[model samples]
Target: MRGPARASYRPVTQRLEVTFLPGLGEIVADEIVERLAPARPPRPVPGREDALLVDHAGRLERALSLRTAVAVFLVLTFDVPRPKSLTSGEHLPRIADAMATSVRLGAARTFRFEAAGHDSSVFQRLAAELAHATGLVHDDAEGEVVVRFRRTPRNAPQPGATRAPTDQAGWDVLVRLGGRPLSARPWRVADFPGAVNATIAAAIVRLVGTQADDRVANLMCGSGTLLIERLLAGPAATAVGVDIDPDAVRATQENLVAAGCAGRATVTRADVTAAGGSWRDAGPFDLVLADPPWGALHGSHVTNPALHADLLRVAHEVGAPGAHLVVLTHEIKVMERCIREADAHWRVRAELRVFAKGHHPRIYVLEHV
Candidate 1:
């Protein structure tokens, strides 16, 4: 009986405490949690109060303290569904205090706060209050704070501080569309090129796992957005974009050239529904990405259902087995139906609900099985 086969256990070493602001979607909050605790299981009970234990790589406990520990507080504020004011300042400080207490208990010495919302004044006040409470001087030079909240039990002086990424870079560059300069504003309700579009584009690049040299296509490539992003990412193997709008095709070409990727990418004027004949010329592509118009949004008078059906038919015909197909649209039911009708042994690897400009844009990633 070899001593029960010597059970092996990995140490539960890294721990992080996170607080979610009211009105932020649970899904987005959960993603933030996952980034911190990649291996921790989901909370077992609903509405239970406990510090979240996240396992980031490395020895994190020694790094904990008021002046020296590395920790961040993320606050997201939005309108509370309906019957609530479109904006409010009532809960901003309360949320900030809640997060501060969490980090204090965790023995984190240094603190950085990030507030995302429509109101800038509320966040500024909250930051001032947090700095005052901790006795940490706000270091405008580095855009963070260093303060000794309390001496540890061992009388060990807390370590010095380092800045959080958000404090430095502001926010992650989630997506780039059609060579537009980066923006920090939220997406609008009536149009595209909002946060939702940026997020979906970033997700596609992340989930599809494309190399710098993989040949990619944007079938029905309106404005050549998807193709432009791919080129910005790297010198892809090759990129071919197609669209029925000659204006859109021309714009795509111009954007690619301006981005210095015209040589690696090309745009042609062709309707995707009739893509079979033309797309064959650009065969053996590694990926196909598109954001077909959700009905009249792309300036077409066609109904959403009809457009969805046509896009799916074209995708099935053009996509090779195992090729990645990434689509972003607002027509949830119609897109689902299109995937079903394809019947080409495809599997949906991921789906995301993006809030842009006021409409919920859903993104679907289908891989041919």
Candidate 2:
């Protein structure tokens, strides 16, 4: 006689509530729904108003309730990249004014202004002006302040790079501004790297919502910046990142190890265009997130319109039905056509314009409808 057979520990899906930050609303919701749909088993709908009842794996549950859930919960902070034409004196006031307007327009609740590529005195002056305009008490040591407004509740302000000191935890995403300077590139063009702009990145992440146990994958993973940030923003299903560039793969691997997420995340070199190639050998994934190369930036060498189409086709083939495909692209016509031609049903969930230098980059939230 033997003891009872050891129980196999299968993962179970749980009900989750998702709130997209201010600008991300329906686009993020649609993306989240699409990503989770294939993994969900068909189940009878539950009676609910303003709530999306979804079948998670084998479990029936409500994932998001517009009425009950706080729709926009996350706030983003960004440091302005120094402009090529501006001197220290001119730059500080311009950034300070921008920050004030950003807060006034409700883009952020609070912000930490930092001086990059210049002396600390510039940042101090900007901070002082921000303090005066917003009626925020300044903390010189931490380089932050609190904004006072009628709508802001007593416990609203939280201390951090992005939020007021009183803001609650569990922010779906957070972004730090300032771009990495590329080697062999001039300072002006090197300001913005492939990593999405900080504010825009946070907005997109909030749009995607958060899942405690959702399996997520990033194809064409660049520096693994998004993956690293996602790991830090916890309660994910699981994460896997792949890049065609071996150097990017190596960097991602090193970053994961350094961030203590090597156990939960993996990075590998895999060409997305290869036929029948699959990341499933890694594990079943729930979400496919990517910032595919923009044709405009890479020109004809790396990413072109044809390559975009091929990538979308491959993404559809590898992705589970109803999985959300969130992508950032500057070429609108190219992406629109690619999605139209792909096998998976795709709908534009959200769109945003990211200004870099003089160009405006478009971020698209595509859903596998």
Tens digits of per-residue lDDT for model 1, 1-369: 456676787764433333222222333235444344455543311122221223444343322311111133222223343212212355334434444544444424344432234135644454466566555444433332222111111122234535322212111101111111122112221222211243345445655665875878887776565676666655687689887878677766776666566788778887777635555577666688888776444634357778777776666666677777888887788788878877665679888665544677776888867
Measured over all alpha carbons after superposition, the RMSD of each candidate to the real structure, in angstroms, is: 14.5, 16.8
Worst 10 residues of 2 by lDDT: 178-187
Candidate 1, superposed: residue stretches over 4 Å from native: 1-181, 184-196, 275-279, 299-302
lDDT of 2 by residue, 1-369 (tens): 999999998755533323323343444445445555636532211221222323344322222222212321112222323322223454434444534543443333445533342236644554566566555545533422222111112243333446544532221111121111111111112122365443344445666666787778888877666665566556676788888877677777776676677788877778777864556565445567777777544435345678778766666666666667778777777877777777346777777765454556677777665
Off by over 4 Å in 2: 1-193, 295-303
RMSD after Cα superposition, model 2: 16.8
Candidate 1 lDDT: 0.51
